[model samples]
Target: MITHIVLFKLKDGIDRDTKQVAEAVAYAREVGHQVPELVDWRVGWNTVDRDISYDFAAIGVLADLPALQRYQENDFHRLAIEKWRLISDWVVADLEDQ
Candidate 1:
């Protein structure tokens, strides 16, 4: 299995209100549920670590490279990536078993 984690730093001047943040997080979570290749998903808004420069983060789990590839190629993921890119800066890391 692999853990694919991403962090986002939203652009300047975007609203960070609770409702707005909640909506974004909800959308992020929804992506995984809609995509079969994603084993799990978790999205979080930057709260305690405001100075770290990222506004949001997501963690996704996949059983293997093929699963990850499928997730990447999915239309839903493409849309999510487009939407996310419009609002934030992002980073990703993929972890695997030894």
Candidate 2:
């Protein structure tokens, strides 16, 4: 299996309480149902308060690399990226799951 992880940080001068951020968060979670390749998914704001901690996190599990790629190219997945870009910058990592 593969785990696709994303960490999102609000952009400079952007606060987490705005309507844009709230909608993006809701959209991120909703995208899971729209993508067929995801075996599992979790999306939410970070719980801890720390400088090193990002504002949001999304973790998705897929069958393998090909499935992960399909998820990346999915229309809803792309839309979620577009939504996040308006309020924050994000980093992603894909890894094999034991």
Each candidate's clash count: 0, 0
* Candidate 1 structure, TM-score to reference: 0.85
Q: Please give the lDDT score for candidate 2.
A: 0.89
Candidate whose TM-score is highest: 2
Best by lDDT: 2
Please give me the total number of clashing residue pairs in predicted model 1.
0
Q: Provide the overall lDDT of each model, using Cα atoms, as 2-decimal numbers.
A: 0.79, 0.89
TM-score of each: 0.85, 0.94
In the range 75-98, model 1's lDDT, one tens digit per residue, is 877877877766677889999966
- For the record, the alpha-carbon RMSD of candidate 1 to the native fold, in angstroms, is 2.2
